[model samples]
Target: MSRPERWIRLRGKPRGPRAFRRDLAETAPGLGAGDLTALLAADGDEILGWGLYHPSSQVAWRELRRGPEPPDEEWVRAAARAAAERRRRSPEIDERLCRVVHAEGDDLPALVVDRYGDLLAVELFSTAALPLARLALPELHEALGTRHHRLALDAAAARAEGEAAWVETSPGCPELVQVEEDGIRFEIDLRRGHKTGFFLDQRENRARLRRQVAAVEEAEVLDVCCYSGGFALAAAAAGAAAVTAVDLDEEALAMARRNANLNRSRSIRFVQADAFGYLRTLAANGRSFDFVVLDPPKFVPSRRERERGLARYHDLNKLALPLVRPGGLLLTCSCSGLLSALEFQERVRQAARRAGRTARLERLTGAGPDHPVRLDFPEGAYLKALWLRIT
Candidate 1:
């Protein structure tokens, strides 16, 4: 009948420690004993993921995947292969730089697979997904036809899961390779450069930026926090007269230079500098552009840092708005999960006001459709983009 009713429908009891009974109250507090039992059963189809649930924590599951049949090597390989196939069809995605297996998106929880050129990067966010990663590696290699595989275990996800910390021997590919999106190529490392190498979730936003770039006739463009030049390349391709791409990462700036060249856009100038410093420099120089892009990384990681992050965002736009000529465009974004969309916009408005610049909101967008957000789970909606016109 209804979506919520259909989703709640379950059958039978799940097999686990008797402690699971005790955990029900603490784990999924709102769910009744019967509802928890039905969740475990899965109507006899077998669950791909299960375990001690922690509804309170951002990570809600201890058992990533389980089934009627043992989830062994074959199953792991098949799952990895299936996930890769799904990403292969997306024209916007560079197969080399993508989320081959996006945890819940691929029906595999606590697992993330990123493809960087010839290398494959794997990160396990939960204990249940670790063994599956080892089992699935060979299959991932076979499916993608790449031997270079690197496992990144730097984050604290392991500690939270009560698992001993283990150093990852492999770091996916050796040298970074070029990943092209919308005629823009970026060199991405399997070992570093944000989540699983590159921000693949910003595919649609980059495309939208490109379209706006194409409409402007010889517009001067500024791309702040120009990680690997995704937005810069798009603007350059759209024929921006002078595109200045700024980033603190030397490696990323080098990649951005290559990306500019790949698109045969000589009009772009790559600058290696802190985004905030660069904005201040622009303001001091009294330089203004027809288009300004502020796509910084996550400023706030948790709720505690939200106010500081919001303040940073406000100050960033305050400096950036003055660098945008009146009647020009400002594309601002926030990838912080800690901040909500309304709060981000309010911060931008505050920034515009502080800069003595009035603006009209043109558009409000989020992560691409591929990175779908479940109606019940707002955490999935992380990226927020706003297009504004300086008045």
Candidate 2:
């Protein structure tokens, strides 16, 4: 059945591709809940795009498609197919585990799809994309060659849309699935894991760390906030003399230990403690590492949290800097979308000054190639990692 369309007129000059939230002058009269509205120009009836109207959300309308034509299941399927094809063509992407659809990167706003071996994990960032995601799933399965799937709603989207946050689409799917990346093995818990079972975006970064450490024998390593020990395992596999992985989550520590055992990486010591306090203890103990990785969770979730987030980043780096031996490598990362790469680098500079050390930036990078960014939307490039060498 064809979907019904409602019309809404914009108030001012047309904004380029954007997420609309109460910026419009007027909405269609008598537009009820669940109406999929087409945005029109203020002066004429020329259609701009299609979006779903939610009266309760600050985002009054969440755009789904851009152009004059109305949106349908076929359009959704085409987007899924295109996203899959792009990933297939990327040499850096491992077909067994990688991102297939990266929300706005694929021009399919608010929907992300990742492949974990035979299992597919889907995430909806907004309620507006829920119906479209459901329509696109069959095509996604065909393109990615997977029938096992899981759907998860962004926590904020769940509250805004008033719907369940998670659902398992395929029965008989295993709770834990093992995936291999760059000759390293990991067991991901699809039902209860961070961001689509694993942090596949850092796949390349971990490999880079391994390659760098492989050249140095008996290198001491530290992985702060290392959920499931991705970097810890990589460093250990590269023949690090000793590796310490720290996180507050006991469940994650347990999994990290299990992963180390799985890979026969006995050098890693899993520690359950707050990262900040642990870093302080390491400094007070006069312990230093040849290499350190700081991959903390998102501190600045929204624009309002920017100031406090920068302070936290500054303090973390200040404590982390003294622990890096002279000429050692420090891989610091920030996943906060509100924090730009320039701002992050500035904060690190401030930390180095406070630590009375000079540092040179070796490399600056973001997520793996699978997580492509749109030219118009720089916010899509959220993950920032700086490889710094202390002097």
Clashing pairs in 2: none
TM-score of 2: 0.94
Alpha-carbon error at 282 in model 1, in Å?
1.7
Q: Per-residue lDDT of 1-391 in model 1, one digit per residue for the tens? A: 1112111212334332222223332222363211221133334323333332332234444333444233445666787788776667777555766667766555555667777666777777655566667867777778777777767653666565455645464644364656667656676764456666677877888888888888988889999998878888888778888999998988778767766677777888888888888888888888999999999888887667877888899989998999988899999999886688898999999988888999899999987644645443455578899999997
Instruction: Choose the strongest candidate by lDDT.
Output: 2
Question: What shift in Å separates residue 145 of candidate 2 from its native position after superposition?
Answer: 1.7
lDDT, residue 121, model 2 = 88
**C-alpha lDDT of all candidate models, in order:** 0.69, 0.84
